[model samples]
Target: MKRRTFRAEVAHVNRPLGEALAAELGVPLEEAARLVDVGAVYVAGRRSRDARTRLSAGQVVTVVLEEGGQSPLAAAPGPAPTLRILHEDEDVIAVDKPAGMTAQPTEGRVGDSLADRVGEHLKRTAGLVHRLDRETSGVTVFGKTPEATTALAEEFREGRARKRYLAAVGPVALPPQGTIDLPLSKDPSRPGRWRATRAANGIPAFTEYRVLHAGKDFCLVELLPQTGRTHQLRAHLTALGAPILGDKRYAGAAQAGGIPAPRCLLHAQALELGHPRTGAPVRFEAPVPEDLARFFAAAGIQAPSGPIRPLEPPA
Candidate 1:
C-alpha cells in the first residue's frame, strides 16, 4: 500500500497533540487521535501514543497516512515469522534478526516483535540484552533467566561488548579508514529525525570505519561504534557525507553503484561478548543476506568468508 508522511512544526503551545495534528493535517481531531492510538504519530523523533500529550511551541510532529487517509499502522495483524536461531543455551539465546522486524513491540501497535517471537518459541520469558533498528539484520542475544539477564545487561551497560557492522554507502571522498566523533541529539526543527549537534548538550557518539571496497558511486565499509547511541551509525555516516544507500531519512541515494537499493544497506555482521553464565568469551556471526551479497557481486567485491576476526583496538 502506498503511504504519505506529513510533518509540521507547532507554532502555538499548550494544546492537545491531537488537536495540533488535526490543524496541521486538515483532519478531524478524532482521526488525529486514532493515528496516535495506532502508533502513526511521532514527536521529536520518537513515537508518541498519547493523543492528550501537551504540545509545546517549536515542537515538531509527524504522521504517516496510507492511501485513502487511513493510518498505515492500522493494518490487519499477521502471524509472527519464524526466527533464525543462531545459538541457544541454558542461559542465553542468540538469533539472527531479519530486516523489517522490530526488536521489540511498540506501544499501540499490534504485532509480534522479535522479543515476542523468541518468547513464544521458548514458551517462557526472554529478556533482550540489546536492540537493533527494525531495518537492521544481525545477531542479537537474549537472556533466559533473571540472573543471566542482569549479567548480560551489565556487560553492555559497562561497554564491554564489541559489535561490528557491514554497510554500503555512497562514494566517500575521505580516507580509506577514519573515525567519526560527533555529538547527536534530536532535531528540534524536524520531527522523527536526529542530527549532529556541536553544542555541548548533545550526546557524545563515536564510530570508526574501514573501507573494504570503493566503486565509482558507492563504497562498502565495516563500522565499529565505540559508543552506542540511537542511530549512531546512520548519523555518523551522514556526517561523513557518505550516507548509506536507500536511507531516505539521511538523504542516501535510491540507487548505489548502478544498483537498486530498496532499504538501508546496513547489517550487524558480528557481536562478541563474555557469556553471562560461564564468563567465557563468545562470538556470533550472521551470514550476509542475499541483498548484500548481490551488492557485493555487483561491486566486484568478494564477501568475507569464514569467521570475521575481532576488530582491532581503536588507534
Candidate 2:
C-alpha cells in the first residue's frame, strides 16, 4: 500500500483540525486523529499532530494517509462508533470513552478497545493512566508520550488525581445518602467479582454517595471512591442495599423496575488532576449520556444539567 496525502484549505476558522481533515477525506474521526498523531497532518509546512488544534481560515492543511492505517473504530464490522477527544495537548489527551468499550486490549481482542482506537489515533501505543469499567462511560485519560504517561501514572498512584461518578440506584432505597467505608477483596467463587469484607487482609475502600433526587422507584446519586479499588462502588452500593440500576452483577437494575438495564448506569462525570507537564490543576467533565439522562427522566429522578458536585466540597 502506498502512502496517500491530501491537501485542503480550511474554509471555517476556529474548527478542530481533525474534524476538518476527516470531512475532507471522508475518514472516520478517529482515523483523522491517528493521522495527526503520526505527523501526517500539517499546517504551514510544519508537522502538527494535535487533533484538537483549531485551524484558522485560509490555513493550508495537509493530511498524509498511511495505507493500512485503519482505526479500530473504523475497522470494526459495522458503522464506527462516535468517540470524541475532550481535550488534548502534546503530552496527553482526554477522550470521552463510550460505554461497553474495554479500556485496552485483552486476550484475543486486539483493536477493539478504547486504547486501540486512541492508540491508533495518537499513532502510538498510549499509556493508560487509569481505567473505567467496560460498562462505564466518561472522560478517560490517555498519555500521548512516555513522559506524560509516567507522570499520569504517578498522579493516580500518589493519590493526587480525583475521580467522581454518577449512578442510578433503586427499588430498595438507601438512607438518603451515606458513605461506605469498608474493605474489599476479590471473591474466590466469582473469579472477577469483588466483595466487601472486614477481614484483616482486605484492602480498605471508601465510597461516598449523595442523593441527587429520589424517584418513586429509583434515586440518582453522585459517587466518589476515595480509593481506586476494582468494583469498589458496585460492592459498596450492594452493601448499602441499593444497587445501581442496570448493574446486574451486583445490584440488579431490573430489580428496581421491570425494565432491563441497557448497560450499567455509571458515568465518570468528573476528573481533577494536575497537568502532566505543567503541574497546573485541570478539571474535565463528561456530559451525561443521552440514554442515562432519559433513564433519569423516566424514573422522575432529576439529572443535573450542569456539572455534578461531590458530597463534600473540594479540599
Candidate 3:
C-alpha cells in the first residue's frame, strides 16, 4: 500500500482540525476530513478526534492513506470452470458463489474470488456491483461493462434492489420468526468489525427472520434485511440469542452436537432487481450450499420451504 503524509499548521486556536488541514493541503474539506473520519489522522502523535474541534497553532497533524492494490491471488489463473453461472445476459450475469470464495479480491486474497473465476469463464472482465461476506456464500450478481456496473450500483443506491439470505441457527426457538430491528455501528476497538447496539449513533438496519423448520439442535431460517450494513445479519442474529452456527468470529465457537458448521451459516438465497439496460425486473436464486445442506441432514431438520419473502415499502 502507498502512504502519503501532509504537514500543516493550526492557524487559529478555534479552527476545526479538518478545516485547517484541508486549507493547508489545498484539498476539499470533506476529502481532508476523511483522515480523521477513518481514524487515520494524528495530532501531535496522538489520535485526533472530531473534525470540528478547535485547533492550536503549530500543532502538527499527519494524514495517511495506505495504498490499495490488487491482491497477488488475482494474478494466478482461476481453476477451469470454477464458477457456476446461474443467469446470464448481455448486460448482467449472476453466479452461484461457493463458500470461502470472495465476491471480489481484497488485500492478500487475490486468486480465489468470484471475479477471477467468472472472468475466466465468460472471457470478459466482471465488475462487482456490490459485495457479500467472504464466509457467506450463495448467489452474487455482476455487471459485464462499466455502464452496466454504474446502472446496477445506482439501483442499489436508490433502494430498488432486494437481497435475501438463508441461514441455520442452532437450537432454534425464535418465534417461527419476527423482525430484529437494531442499529449497527463499527466497534470502536476493532477496525473492520461491527457490533449491534441500542446506541443512537449507528446506522439504521433491520432484519426479518422466519423459522422454516426446527430440529433437536438446529433451525433453518429465511432472513430479509431492509437495509444493508456491515455484518448486520450476523450481529442481529447474535443479539437474538440464535447466532448462526459455525460463525466463529462473531458467535465465539461452534457448539457440540450442533450440525458442525465450518463457515458462517448464511447464504445469499436470492437477488431481485431491474436490468440495467432494459429496465425490466429480474430475479435470481441459489440453492443452499452443500455444507449447510449436509449440516441440516445430519441434524435431522426438514427442508426449508418458500422462496424468500420480499418486503414492500409502506404504501
Candidate 4:
C-alpha cells in the first residue's frame, strides 16, 4: 500500500466537519467520514470520529491518504520506527523528541520525519504545533486536531507558554542571573546564520538566563526567551561572551584543551502549557540526554535541582 499526507489550516468555519475535510482532500463525504472512523483525520492535533464536528477558523487539519485502498478505515502497519511519548490526551500529545531529528518531513526524504512517526502512533495524522532545533532535544507538542493546533500556537505567540532550556556555555563574563536584550536578524550576507546587531531590520529578541552551575571555564545556564526567533538563545549567549559549548557554528571552538564536545550543548529540558482541551496547566520535563550528561560530568557540574520555570516574558 502507498500513502500520502496533506495538511491545511481550517479555512471553512462553522461548516460540517465532514464536508470541510471532504472538500479539502478532494474525496467524497463518505470517504471523509470513514477517514474519521479510522482516526485518519485530525483537527488541531487530536483525532476525531465525528463527521459532524464543527471546525474553527485558523485550525489545522492533517489527512493521510492511502493511494490504493479498498477501505478508508482499513488499518495500516504498526507505529513508526521510534518515538518516546511523554504525555498524551484526546487533543494533544507531548513527545520526547530526541536530538538530531527533524520536527517534520523534509522534501525528498522518505518515511523518516518525526511527524510521520507521530501519525503512525495516532493511527491518523498528527501535526507538529511547535518546533525544537534538531540539535536541541526535548519535549515537543503535537495537536491531534486543527483546533488544538490553533489554540496552542496562539499561546506560544501570546507568551502564555513557558519553556526552559539548559545550555553548557564556554568561558565568558556573565552575571549570576540577568537578561540579554539583543535585536536579531538573519545575516543575508552570511546566509543561515544570525547576527546580534541592531541592523535596522533586526527584530528585538529577549532571553533571560541564570547560572545554575558555574566553574572557572564553563557554566550550565538556564534560558527563557521572549521571542521564538531562529537561533535566539545561541546568538544572545554568544553576544554575552559565552557561546554554547560544542556549538561550532556560533562558538569558535568545538573543543578546548583536553575536553571534547560530542554535540551541541543545548537541551530543551522542560515545557509548560495550558491544556488545549481543559485549560488546566501542565508541565513536562526531559532529563538531560547522555551527551549532555557527559558534558556535565566533565565540567564537574550538576544539573539544576527541582522544576525551573520561566521567570519573565521575553521583552
Candidate 5:
C-alpha cells in the first residue's frame, strides 16, 4: 500500500502530540491519537508511540497515513461496552472487566476501554489505578477523584496492594507452590513483547504460584505478583515451562483437557488494598466468567471456592 506523510512544526509549548497532529491534519483528537499509537507520528524525526507526548515550541512533527485505505478520520466507532460494577463509593470504583476489552485506549482503537466505560457510567472521568491485559477478565479498580487516584497509585507502586490471578495452564513439572524470581526485559527482536532474562540490567520480577487444581492434562494455578512489571506473570510462567493456556504470545498450548482454548485462560480474580480515603482495608472479587467456568467444568477441575491465600509472606 502506498503511504502518505504529513509534516508540520509545533507552534506552541507543552502541547500534546495528538492535539498538534489533530490540528495539523484537521481530524478528531481520537483519530490523531490513533495515528500516534500506530507509530505513524514522529517528533523531530524520531518515531513516538505515546499520543500524550508533550511537544515544545518549534519542534517538527510528522504523520504518515496509508493511501487507498480507510482513513482513521473516516473510521466508525464501535458501540459502547458496559462494565459490571463490583464496588463504588465517593472516592473509588471497582468493576468486573470482561475479556477482549482493554483497560485503556490502545493502538488502532478508540474508546471501548474499561476506563472509558467507567467514565461513561460515572458521567465523569475515572482514573485507572492499574491495567489488565486485553484478554484477562476480572476485578479492576479506578479512582473517582484526583486525591484517590494519587493515593491508590502510590499503594500499587509501593507494592502495598495485593493482586491475585487465576490461570489454567498445561501440565506443570515445578513444585505445587513456589515463587518465580526471574527478571524481565523487553524482547528487542519482538516489538511489543517481553521475556524473562538473566542479564544484569533486567528489571526484577517475582510471582508466587500455588496449584489450585490438577487435572489429567491441565492445572489451575493461583498467582500472586509481588512486583507490577509489564507481562511479568505471562513471562515468568512461560519461563517455568507452563505458560498460560491460550496465551499464544507465550507459547501456551492451544487446547487444554480436550477443550479448545478461546483466549488466554487467565483472570484477575481479586484485588485488595486500603481504602484511599479512609485507610481501611478494602477488597474486590470478580466471579469466573463463562469461558473459564466452562473450561474448568469440561476439564473436571473445580475452581477455588474463595480467594486463594498467598503461599508466602505478602510483599
Candidate 6:
C-alpha cells in the first residue's frame, strides 16, 4: 500500500497540538485529538498525541493512518509478526526492536511494523507510543490505551524518560565525559536525511556522551540524547570528529574502509519510563547485536565483563 504523503506546513507557530493538527488536516478537534492519541500522527517521526503540544512553524508532520482507525490505509493483515517482547502489562508493552525493521510501515512498504507485531502479541488492543530508527536495535515501548499513551507521551515530552545508547566508534579521541551541543538540520543536499549544520534555522540538539571503554582499534561510547531530534546522535558524533564506525550516511570513511558491517555501529541500549497503568517506574534493555559482537572479535577486543545491564533511570 502506498502511503499518502503530506508536506504539512505549520502556519501558526507553537499552537496547541489539537488546534494545530486539526487545522492542518481540516478535521474536527475531537477527531484529530483521537487520531493523535492513538499514535496515528507523528511529529518528524516521533509520536505526538497530545492535543496541547505546541507546534513550531515549518515542522513537517507525518500522519500514519492506523489500520483499524478511520483513515485511508488498507486493512491490516492478521497474525502480527513475531517480536521479542521484553515486558508487558495492561498499561504498556516493551519490545526489543531489531535492526533493519522499521518501527512503522511507510509509503509502498508492506511488512510487519513494530506495532503490527505487537498487536498480534497483545490480547487487548495495543498501540505504539514511541519508536526507534530502523537501524537502531533496542527497547521500544507502547501504550495499551489513550490514557497510558498520553501519560507516557508526556514523560517523553518533559524529557523525564531516560534513554541510554551504546555505540562503537572509530578510534575515539575525545575525553571520557563530555556533551555535544550542536545544532542540526536536514541536509539540503539529501531530503529525508539529517546533518549537523550551523545554519541559523537548525534545531537545537544536545547529546551527552562518555567513553565507557577504549580498546585496540575501537571505543565503546555511551550516549544520552537530551533532545529527540532526527539523527541527533549520528549528526552530533560526526560533528564531534568521531562518527560512528559504520555510519555510512554521516561518516566519511565507512564505505572506503570496507567495514565488515554495512549497518551503523549504534545501538539503543536501554529505556526507562513510568508504567502507564500503575505509575510505577519501569525499564528495559537489550544487549549488543551479533554484528557488533563480531566486529569486536575481529578487532580483538575483550568483551566487557558482566551481563548486559538492565535499563535504569538516572540516579
Local accuracy by lDDT, each model: 0.79, 0.75, 0.73, 0.74, 0.79, 0.70
Can you write out model 3's per-residue Cα lDDT over 23-104, one digit (the tens) per residue? 8668798876665654456676555546886777666666554423532222333344356788998888899888777776
Candidate 3 wrong stretches, greater than 4 Å: 1-81, 190-192, 252-258, 298-307, 311-315
Query: Which residues of candidate 1, in runs, are more than 4 Å off?
Result: 1-79, 305-315
Give the winner by lDDT: 2 or 3. Answer: 2
Model 1, global lDDT? 0.79
Q: Candidate 2 — which residues are off by over 4 angstroms?
A: 1-76, 255-260, 299-315
For model 3, where is the 10-residue window of minimal lDDT? 67-76
TM-score of 6: 0.67
Query: What digit string (tens of lDDT, one per residue) describes model 2 on residues 1-315?
Result: 223344445454787888887888888988778767644555755556588888775677655443246533343445448668889999889998898777875432213578878977878889998999988999899888889999999989998888888887775566666778989988887777788878636889998887777777767778877899898888888777777778878745653544446778889988888899999988888888875786676766655544445576544
Clashing pairs in 5: none
Cα lDDT tens digits, model 4, 140-178, are 898999999888888798888888888887776677788
lDDT by residue (tens digit), candidate 1, 68-187: 344464573455567999999999999999888789865323335788789888898799989998788888999999999999999889988888899888887777777788999987
C-alpha RMSD in Å of predicted model 3 compared with the true structure: 11.5
Give RMSD (Å) of candidate 1 vs. truth. Answer: 7.9
lDDT for each residue of candidate 5 in 63-97, tens digit (9 for 90 to 100): 55652376533443455556699999999999999
Whole-model lDDT, model 3: 0.73
| Local error of candidate 1 at residue 176 (angstroms) | 1.4
TM-score of structure candidate 5: 0.76
Weakest lDDT window of 10 consecutive positions for candidate 5: 1-10
| CA lDDT, candidate 5, residue 2 | 30
